[model samples]
Target chain A: MSVGASINARGLTKSYGSGEGAFHALGPIDLDIKPGEFVSLIGPSGCGKSTTMLLVSGLEPPSAGSIAIDGRPLTKPITEIGIVFQDHLLLEFRTAMKNVLLQQEIRGLDRAESRQRAEHLFARLGLVGAEDRYPWQLSGGMRQRVSIARALVHDPSMLLMDEPFGALDAISRTQIRHDLEMLWLETRKTVLFITHSIDEAIGLSDRVFVMSRSPGRIVDEIKIDLPRPRPAHLGEYPDFAAYTKRIYSVFEKLGVYKFD
Target chain B: MSDQIAPVTSPPTPAARLIRAGWLWSILNSVLSVVIFLALWEGLIRLFDVPVWLVPKPSDFLGRFLVDYPEILRNALATSVTLAAGFGLGVVIAVPLALLMVSIGALERGLYPVIVFLNIMPKTVIGPILIIWFGVSPLVSVLVVFLMCFFPVLVDSMHGFRAVDPRLDYITRSMGATPWQAFRYVRLPASMSHIFAGMRIGIVKAVEGVIIAEFIGSSAGLGFMIMRASSFMNMELLFCGLVAVAIVALIFNALLATSERIMMPWVRPR
Candidate 1:
């Protein structure tokens, strides 16, 4: 099965509040994501990367403009989109396997098949022995992995991850990043990953979309032409530093960083 | 490699052992205290040659209870039935009211202050009024119990529902869970401890409510037996009636604790 979905946004805009109090969070922006592509959205805080993901996932409607997924207008419920957040957000009362099965429950999938799928996903995520453990019993990294397993349990074509590893320690963050990259490579799902770390975006993304603050819009798009099966040691490469330097320059030009 | 993995065996701490022994020690202490008090009373009665009608010795009370055990048991059953009916009714009424309070902000704002005022009012004063309206029937007694028990359950459930983590709601919504699903999976399960806490208090109040209603009007329950014994200065029978009430309350509370344990095995009692 082809695990990809084309996403289109034309003049997408989102605002909070009304009239005098209205604050624009995003465009009037246009973008396109080809199927099976890994895209990372990088920007300063309040640049609306998170808001853009929310709009694209059909959790919230765009204030203006249009969004389409797989050539269908994204007006109704978009069941094919998977979303993960900064917080693990696992239900503390449920076991890891049960939490993963929640996607099947919400999507109205058959019980026996969903449970089998959940077990397979848990095994693939290296949580085979810990399926019955509750969220509170697991470490932070383990809990976040459970969240990922839950997001992918239904085999969603598009995965929207907003700072999914932000709460992990440095070591766990690196490990999860490697795991995520391998998962992406194997599944070839269209991924929209949002993060603040330029290194993470450069390390994982096929393309990076950088945004400007205060009425957010995509200000720069950088293609990472690094080889497939990128090594963890690629961060040490001169080319990786060059890409980081270019993205940092965009941030500098946007006045997102102040030296004085 | 052997040093890398330590064996995970440790003896129970002194604190854990103490906690394990705590309940037995408390029960023994309580028994000792009651025994000493009863011995003192018996000695006083024997030495002073007081009339049995004035103040019954422990033996006298126990003897009367044993002789009329069947009658006492029957009356106790009547009281227990009334308590169950009233408490069940109160819980049924309060839970929906609490859910309504969570769903409708305007309704909550309008009703909460009035509920607080009603809760603080002297509920005992309404006992006579209920008797007059429903005429010493089981319905009147049950209604009284319901009135006494309803407010605490309502207030606690409302607080519990309101206390559901907003982040969890966001998670549920993002997962495409409907409003009912959010309530069933997130809000209701999250509020389990609070609801049970309310029920624990409400059960006690329900027992008290039934006794008070019976004391005011009815002639069948332990409350009625106590009233009659007090009027005739039969202190032994009165003490027996009081003991029956205490035992009923104890049993009800124990059942509530057991049910809570079953429902929320994950929650540890502090």
Candidate 2:
């Protein structure tokens, strides 16, 4: 069993260029995630949700603040992490199996163990026969599933998913949401999922952080107290509707939804 | 349910069969068209009683091909060897140089403009200049072919390497991939389809370059044979030389297409 790492950030900010021309992308924000917790950042475009994920992954340096993973100040891209992007970001050349194995190949992990784990993940993700297919051969939904398997193959301590199901069809979105929740129930990896879907943010996450537009800051944090295995029709759950309404009101206040 | 199963169990439909046999069918179609064209040419030439010096009949070149088989074979072989050498060298040099240039911003900024300037100038003009520099040797022919191919391969390869989505780099870096590992696993494979596209253009240019070089400097090769045949008014031999060059170019293209399929199987129609 793999224990998840807690994520900590203080005054995390990112700005591109300099002086009068500088574009402030994110932050002067603070975030703390407990071990094995599921959290989501929901906001409009340009809210720096993706930027926040990038900084936490340490793929890019923050202009002004600091991040600590498992209480260690991060100076480099952390290895014990999996990242999924909206584009699926799969290498078109490799088969689905090889793409999943790439994590093991890069990390120099035990080959047989990684292969076994990858096979298990494939089975769990409903990707049994898709291991040999290239990204182009698979449907949009199957491709996303393969990407998810790749993210989890190495059993990372933290999973950072940025709109993993945004491009998927409605059915795939629902199915993958359920599958992701079930997987989280099993591994309990610390997850920081970013999305524009309010229902998704509330349904999958233990806590949802609503962010403001442009120089984004976490405007509100809503903890969902709903029962586990959240119902497919989230509208049936009174608390789910309350959570949705609360996030909507934050967006409305931020001028995302305007009424004359 | 029975209707759905019936379709699966039945023989393949005509459209499916045609698509499955598409490659062979296309080749046969091309062969048929060429044969018809040759028959028309042979008939017209015989009807007009035209002199062979003016334009040899298809049969006339066919006869020439049979009688001068050894000579044509030798010259064709020479041309093939020179083309292979020059094109191979160009690929070897250009791909790595493109990689280096793409990796280092300063090198790309410094060198790309000069490369573009060179590419814009006519490579044909440089054939005679190369002969003058290298003194009418096989080396001059090789150098000309190299010059012809180098630019396109380099430019397209640079484009391929730089065309990678920035998110891909982040994906690899998040996994703690070293720069070399990221390049080897991701950048190189991602660039292959583009690299092969460059090679396709390079091979065509190479065929043209070899003939130009042989036209100016070499005493051997199909180009030299064509020149010799023309001077003696042996139209049949000139036509034979031309046919040989066409076959060689086709072969190079076929080889490249096969390699592309092997290297980047994802690009093949599923």
Candidate 3:
């Protein structure tokens, strides 16, 4: 298992175009995620949480600011990481197993070892018997699981998920959230999970950073003291409810919800 | 719930049975319709005492088809060669050209309007020009066919390449995929169905092109044979050539469909 790398961002910002037509997507925000920590960037639509995740992964260069991974400045894309998008994004031509093995194929990892890891991941993600099936053959949730398996198959030190379960049905989302939490507990890879769901952020993250809408910056950060493998009925816990209320209040204060 | 429903192991339902036997039924239906139409044509021609020069009876056409089998086969071989050569060249050139144009924005900008202008000009018009330039040779027919086959494949290929979801690039990039790896693993495979679709259209256009080219300038081919038969007023031979061209087109389409199924097994019906 690869040990997680600490992700540090200083004054990270992203802008599209320039001058009069410029769109400020993200902020001159500073973020520090400890190694092995599971952090969630929770925000509303267009809050730039996704931008922050992309910048951290170094998939896109920040318009301005700096990012360092494991104390090393990220000059190019950080390849030692797995990313999951809301869309399953499985290569339709590849089988569910082959989709996961794509990482190994591209990265030139040990084929035998990677295949074994993929099989293990398949089982863990409840994707057994689905290895040979194409993406079109799988359910929404099952497809998402395959993508998650692909992310973990390479055993990257960090995982970046941008609303990985956003497209799933409610029940599937709950089940997958539970499964993801279990996997994270086992691997303990530094996770930067971006989501709009407060419950999901609070349910899974070690720390949740709440951001305001558009030109999004972290407005508040809340640390969850919830127990490991958190209870399904998180609303029952006073502490959990308090965390939820705190995040909701932050959003409310930002005028996300308005009452006349 | 999985995208596919559970496989039916019990007795097949009425709908399931119909679907299971659908292809066979459709083939039988088409054959029956053709037979009925032919029977009607044969009867009407005989009753009217129609001259063979005007319109040969189905019997005479089939008779001429067998009697002149060697000659018809020779001409068909010529046409097939032209079709294959032209279509093959078109695919080889158009697909790569499309990839280049799509990969390079400047190339797309510089070349797309020129391509559109060329495609807008009628292929039949190009046939005479090609003949004038290349003389009465097989190369003229092949070049005409190439012009007809190139545009659709190029346009559709560009469309396919552009249609790839941007997020897929992000996923592949995170996997340490180089630009070439990303294209090979993602873009190329993703664009395959579209490429095949373009090839299908291109092949049909190629058939039209080859025949027109042969009509204009070719010394041989089914089109050339038809022109020759018409000059001699041998309607039977003319009909035979027409049927041969139709059969050849059908065979080409069937080959294309089969290869498409083989190449894209994921799209195969369960």
Candidate 4:
């Protein structure tokens, strides 16, 4: 029971608008994520990866499906899940320390312990001097790292990130990806990550779920059998390249070769 | 493979360059503008031999203002007190009212239009009515300032709260924050810059409202002094009263700018 919680979503679907303009954003599909596994959902735009993330995080209810975490039905937002959006979304008035402690305030948890934990998390995220810095005072990369720190401060069992590094430059993107990989290795929390980049999916995920567009659903699932504590540069490895090629081939089938 | 790393010195942005305009230059430009305006005023008065009764020379106005400084200061203080009281009350009331309006769609439908209707009426009509009700007491001046400040704040707060990033609001909900906690911790701070901007406008309006109230009913503020001096044909005193009003406006503005800087240090004070 104390192990990282797994997600089981059955017949999950999401539809927007009404009548003639009705749009099915996500699937009548089934998905399962095992405990302590790192799963990546990679797809083209409008493949409903974000919609799927929202459903599992319990922020949005499915049109006709059920999502249970560790065999328990999740009706609303539970404390065991942490989510990071694309933007930092830090309160400009608050410091990084205060922003991280916002989770504690929401849950009415112990302040002193939460503050101690927040500081520890910040240090772990390489934000050693940023605890007192306001969001504007930090650079874009630093701000993004602070956002990651805020999400992980509560120490949730499951972490859902929707393209957290999507907004960064090439250099920062590579750097943050390395940081994320190391963090995941140390924590081994059940992570469900969404990204549009095939390389990011193949580089970080143990299991990658490739989705199809136009009433989005999972089309293919690939497991990267690369060894744990893997090499720093994923592209240098032949097996990583093989995994990436297969995922891109799925995109060609779906006619999403634009970015490939 | 080459081990050499490239230097990462990025070019400065245009906005960063614009902010490099020094404070000394800013102050010098302002002072030069005032000097030129005073020179023109002095030249016109002396050349036209304008009657002191109709348009007192700048020299005459300055001298008389200095002589009547004590009386002017008293009236200015009285007017400022009213403005402060009203401005404080306006923010306290309007922020909560706006929170109520934005949080519940039904209440917004029921009450927002009525609020708009009340705000649309020119305070000129409302001033006399308020004076009639409160009757020459200091309370009349306070009420008018409150009325002048109330609408802008209510409208601005409503806009700010409603315009908060929905994604950020979703974060609060997912974090298990109560609605009140969300408003206090997230929505209110998110809209702080807008709220302060509204308060600046409210401060200016509060000053105008108090003067109007004083002119219409009371006999204890700069507006009342202006009226009294004009009726008696003491042109210098009238000029002095007007100067007092200008000084008060500047003081109020400076105070607000200072507080804005203190509260939102992220926004470099302009």
Compare the candidates by DockQ and give the number of the best one.
3
For candidate 2, give the lDDT of residue B248: 84
Worst 10 residues of 3 chain A by lDDT: A129-138
lDDT of 3 by residue, B1-270 (tens): 232322323334434444454434545666788799889999999999998888889998988877899999999999999999999999999999999999899999999999999999998897777777889999999999999999999999989998999989889888889899999999998999999999999999999999989998989999999999889888889999998998788778766766776567665354
lDDT of 2 at B190: 95
- lDDT string for model 3 (A102-143, tens) is 999999999999999999998888888788877887788888
Off by over 4 Å in 2: B1-30
Kindly provide the TM-score of model 4 when superposed on the true structure, using C-alpha atoms.
0.88
**Candidate 3 residue pairs in clash (backbone atoms < 3 Å):** none
Query: What is the per-candidate TM-score for chain B?
Result: 0.85, 0.88, 0.88, 0.86
Which docking band does candidate 4 fall into?
A: acceptable
Chain A TM-score, each candidate: 0.96, 0.98, 0.98, 0.95
Q: If scored against the real structure, what TM-score would every candidate get?
A: 0.87, 0.94, 0.95, 0.88
**Candidates in order: C-alpha RMSD to true structure:** 4.5, 3.8, 3.3, 4.7
lDDT of 4 by residue, A31-62 (tens): 89999899999988888999998889888888
Interface RMSD (C-alpha) of each candidate? 5.9, 6.9, 4.2, 6.7
Question: How displaced is residue A229 in candidate 1, in Å?
Answer: 3.5
Ranking by DockQ: 3, 2, 4, 1
Question: Model 3: residues >4 Å from true position, as ranges?
Answer: B1-33, B268-270
The lDDT of model 1 is 0.82
Per candidate, the number of residue pairs that clash is 1, 0, 0, 0
Please compute and give the TM-score of the first chain of candidate 4 against the native first chain: 0.95
